[model samples]
Target: MTETGESGGRKYDPAATHNFPDERLNAILPDLLSDPEITTYLEAQNVNAVTRKGYNDHGTKHVEIVRNRALNLYDLLKGGDVGFNGAIDQDLDEADEPVIIALAATLHDIGHVVHRDEHVYYSIPLAADLLDRLLPEFGFYDASEAVRMKAEVLHAILCHHTEEDPLTTEAGVIRVADALDMERGRSRIPYEKGGRGINTLSSQAIESVSLRPGDGSPVLVEIEMVNAAGVYQVDNLLKAKLDGSGLENHIRIVAVNTKAEDRLVERIEL
Candidate 1:
């Protein structure tokens, strides 16, 4: 929360909060935001009815959700007693990795501007363009950091949908948050109306979301749905992917009973 410039922007020392420096991340955000192709991608989805809900899925909302979700995941890791697992050292703080997680969360859905079906594909190229633009801004002035940023962002974007993708520490955290999104905070009207089948629409009606920490294992993600349209439809689509995620052993989704139980409903879990 230190401001260094005239614009009053943050002057974060990456080591102050994370292992990576602020210069490294600040160097890349604009690049990620500047690509003409990415701009086009954002513009396309900016108009989608599903994206307009509650000021939570729009421009700032996108990054806001990402930041919150990433931080939450980090906190869950620490609280669940797993933060020190993997490459994490006893003396090192995991919070330092937040910048990478936050940035990835911010950019992961940029591909959604093109299409929602596996936006991860669009995320990769868009991330590359963003890194190209970011290098000069961060005083990298050299190619080394530029290359590093590209690799980092690409890893983050590709792995956000599935945990099987190879990833750095930051990428792994962002991936968990992205998967936990579960359409939890999104509006159901537009999605329910336009979806072709029951599964697609049900998948759209997420109401409550939470993260459960695992003991040196994959995090468990809990999503509660209102199930306004059809429960089974949403469950089938999300379950397959969640199960496929390496987190199947640790990820547990608990669907609570609600009044709108009008479809092929399971009694316990979604």
Candidate 2:
């Protein structure tokens, strides 16, 4: 269960269950990671999925993974001079980009409380109310600024699904980040209970996914699989999520088989 990567010449555990480290995040949104409302909502979402829907883990763990990965993509692209939709247009401050991305990534799946299909649209209002209450606690007391931030966060949540196009850099990052939560542990619960089909099998084949700086691109998404069949998760699920995302040009995805001497399975770049 150990996954590793390097950033700024330092080693980090990608599979670690703790919050991702970011100094700016601590200054701007110090209360978000431990917010009671967010924690309660995530717990309820997991109960709904496991008790009623028979789905895999889409709770706090999934959201945290998305949050970390989305922020990683955002920072990499921003460092490489990629312009964010809100920042480039003067709608959101550059410093606020990570906050919005993290909020959107963390709350995107809360709508499963209502239903699974079209949960993206349902998530908008749910996340908006939560943001309205939570933003001011973090010093976003200005009315107009809070309203604008809420709108942007909702947009990112709505666009995390493939049916919707992510118009902003943050939203695009959230979309791809959501898809990267395909490690086998994510589906182990349902798979062991006789979960069948491509979704479960593809997830089971994924051994690990790592995000790091790339040589040719701004970010590299390296996926290691126990079987070549895991390519279905990358090609069908992850690729669909990244195709319409605005961050595609800044990313390069490579999948390899760990059981096959690290043989290259699939490589995609746009």
Candidate 3:
């Protein structure tokens, strides 16, 4: 974590990914994050998401948060005895699941480097290009395996947005994990810049979110809210992503206000 890589009051932390149990993921992450090509893409994306649109982070900080949450969610589901495999694609070895998740989460928003409008569609070609250059560098995947991995990663990126449906559990996990970066820190850019849109206001209301094993479900998403207004984030955005994420039945979402609800701005924008 460096002071320069932070934005919107959020600091990028690669520590959790280092703790991931997957040897392939652990080996690949340090190289992938430091790759000049990938770093360039993340910077360009912020130009669009932050400088262009005043949106929450979609750069290194955002990706790191999603990567951590995606892996943690995968771990909770696996530990809770869920039947779904992270590598839901039949051709992929079960061992490659975390690699798929980390890769997809890392590259998913690079398409934002192209444009924020339908960035999901733009991400496909860029990710495919990077996969070509990086997968071979790992010296692990043969040509055939590398091609299959490309399809899997592209699928996850496309499906992270609601426009596409996720066919694999891995894609679904990426979709849901993308939305989990909704704490107040993510709203600092918009809020500090004098933006009071609903997106920023609701996100600012979120204090923290945690994932753990659940008694009734494979995973529990417990959200701590500073005010009731944050419910809009859970019910409107998160619930939509979760509904089609295939892990819907396996995960439970609950939000609670830790204090008396404060008055949120009434002037709202979506």
lDDT of each: 0.51, 0.76, 0.80
lDDT of 2 by residue, 79-169 (tens): 6777777643546566677778878987999998888767777788899889889888787447877888888888889899988898888
Query: Which runs of model 2 end up more than 4 angstroms from their true locations?
Result: 1-24, 88-90, 261-270
lDDT per residue (tens digit) for residues 173-256 in model 3: 999999988988798987899989988999988887777778788788878778867878888999889888888889888887
The alpha-carbon deviation from the true structure for residue 19 of candidate 3, after best TM-score superposition, in angstroms, is 14
Model with the higher lDDT, candidate 1 or 3: 3
CA RMSD of each candidate after superposition? 7.8, 4.8, 4.7
Higher-lDDT candidate of 1 and 2: 2
Write one digit per residue (lDDT tens) for candidate 1, span 1-270.
232332112222334443323454455456654656555655565444245431224333444455556655554554444332222321222332554565566677776666566667876887677667754555643576446555665776787675445335556566555544445334334444564444345545555555545444445555555655434533554464445444344445666535454444433463
TM-scores for all candidates: the values are 0.61, 0.87, 0.88
Prediction 1 TM-score vs. true: 0.61
| Worst-scoring 10-residue span by lDDT in model 3 | 1-10
User: Positional deviation of 98 in candidate 3, in angstroms?
Assistant: 0.6
Q: How does candidate 1 score on lDDT?
A: 0.51
Superposed on all Cα atoms, model 1 deviates from the true structure by an RMSD in Å of 7.8
Model 2 worst lDDT window (10 residues): 4-13
